[model samples]
Target chain A: MKTRDLGSAAALAILGLLAAGLAGCAPGFDHLEIKIDTLPPLAVSVDPTNVELPVGIAVGITATPFDTSGDKMDSDVVLNLVPKNQKVLAVETSLDDRSFVLFGVGPGTTSISVQVDHESRTDIPATVKLQPME
Target chain B: MIRKLLLLLPAAGLLVLTGCPVTDASTGELSNGRFAYLCVDSSDPTCDGIVGKAVIPDLLAVGGAFDLEYAGDSGAGLVQVQPASDVMISSTAGTFAFRIPGIAAMLAKNNGGVVADFVHLRGVDVDHLDVLGESLAESIKTLEMTTGVAAALAVSPRDRLDARLGGALAYTWASSDPSIVAVNMASARNSVILAGIAAGTATVEVSLRSGLKMAVLVTVKQGVPMTTSSSSGAGGSSSSGSGSGSGSGTTTTGAGGAGGGK
Candidate 1:
């Protein structure tokens, strides 16, 4: 009789655990809801694609990136200023890492290409004209 | 019966263990996402990075290894997370955690989504990595050029005409009205001699590879120019073993060219 009582109690525990396990196995149970964003940017862009600066003056630059959906992606982009005339134009990046300072060293034009990761890049044509800072 | 119960006990424990599936707990969700980054500055010397913002920074120093943390509905604060180099589990306070390495490469390998907005660096202040509008497009200034003799086409700073390709001292010149006055680029290194074939107004232009250009109106009178002068500057035609004494008059009208509007 004692064995019978012990067996029934053990069975109850097992049933209870199995019921809980079944519930846990159900969909939407305690599962790690992970959605790793894995989309490559199709286009790279910059804010104010065109910029101008006077001699001895400076401007900030912003590079933007977009994915295949044409959505502005949240990613790191590289900015490169290819000034046709470096004597007339120069660029420096800020610590903020988001903006760059364009100095009108002299007078001329440049091409700013922002690379969106290793996959894509876009060019923004920038022109700098000298206005003698009197 | 006892044996049967004993047999079920192990399975019971296993079920109980499995029951703790990481679903919506009474508190919040446990899953989250991550990313990595690298950056450079526009400063001098080593413009790679700055702990913050600065005018003068170590040149060519590119700082990197930034990341992101996006949590699901469970707003409960992160509890315990393995703060290691190889991996990161979301259910912890791993946001901006530095000890983590290879996250950037891992994400890159995954071809994960990238964010251009902001980042949190361990040794550096959290800041926006990419920004715009520091300097704006004020007014476009056109490249300046002067009118030339109708029958003669040549480059001359003395004529108040400048044409530099990529800001180099060389360029290719063309005439809008070639019949009135034609330009031959092959004849000269920096100068485009205008051969006045007839009397008419023509547009003489100088340009560079960056799409930068300058144009001016040239009203060719009856006669070809007696002498053609070369510009005297670093990239000047005159300075390049060439001579410039005079053009009819000072340059007039610095008009628009290819890259002016841009």
Candidate 2:
């Protein structure tokens, strides 16, 4: 009887341990997720496409900014004249508007590019002819 | 039971630990937005480095655009002028002719000398002919021929011209339209030069003749000082456990008892 009791007690203890282990495993899985929204597309278009101005004269240029979502982006748009050596001659900013006018450029043919937050968004090569005062 | 409890303790602790959310170091609220700082060292003769520092601002507002022109010791080359409208000039040996109507012929005549030699008009207004000259024609002609609508002509003093010409022949253009406004070349230069040098404390004047009416000043300084600094943090938690048990007693005693009974 004593031996049977000891065996039963040992079995009970083992059962209890198994029950505890099973209880620990009962909780359902938890999932946490993080996601970022897509950024809006930015587009730029220049009017007149080409410009010619005599040296010492100021040429006014207009740059238009557009976003894919039709929602106006508050980002500032900058117009820069990039020379062959990649040196930036002039940088002008337009705020919350579709167009900007840049004045007083020196003589030279260079690429005009637009940057949004320092990111090159669009580039168009342009020729500038500066005629000496006759 | 106690052993089972002990086995479960680690699992329970783990559940508690896992229940807490992990904090991402990179996900903290930003204290500020970014900024670009440029410091040019013009004071130190040996140090010509331009230090650019990017800093995060305390809060993100709509960013602004900036255009900064630095005028240094490198002088801008020459004076330039731009005409507001088209101008036409006809030059004859001793006389200058302008296409503008109603101007007298006397206003067109100048002692056969280069226009550059007389009347060094830097930034004269085309509308102002009285001070510039009588011949609106001459003004128009100069404007048409020059990149700038304005021309700078230096008129030698009569005494000087008399001495220089030695009375061989001398002529001057007179304008019938005395009401025309003329821009003061000297004043214009002063204004432009001041505008160019406004950025630096050092009074180095740089003048460059960029175009007709375009003058640029490039300024270089010896030294400018600059400084910068940055910091960041992250954290996580986990727990786990397992347990097992078995028991048996007295097989030898039972075998001996069975032998005795047999």
| Maximum-DockQ candidate | 1
Q: Is the docking of candidate 1 incorrect, acceptable, medium or high quality?
A: incorrect
How many angstroms is residue B41 displaced in model 2 relative to the true structure, after the best TM-score fit?
A: 36
Q: Write down the TM-score for model 2.
A: 0.22
Please compute DockQ, using alpha carbons, for every candidate against the native two-chain complex: 0.01, 0.01
Model 2: per-residue lDDT, tens digit, B148-227?
A: 12333322111111221000111122221111112232222211111110111212121212111211112312111112
- Stretches of candidate 1 above 4 Å error? A1-47, A76-85, A118-120, A132-134, B1-262
True contacts kept of 1: 0.00
**Regions of candidate 2 where Cα sits further than 4 Å from its true position:** A1-48, A60-62, A75-89, A93-105, A132-134, B1-262
In order, the candidates keep a fraction of the true contacts of: 0.00, 0.00
RMSD of each: 27.0, 44.9
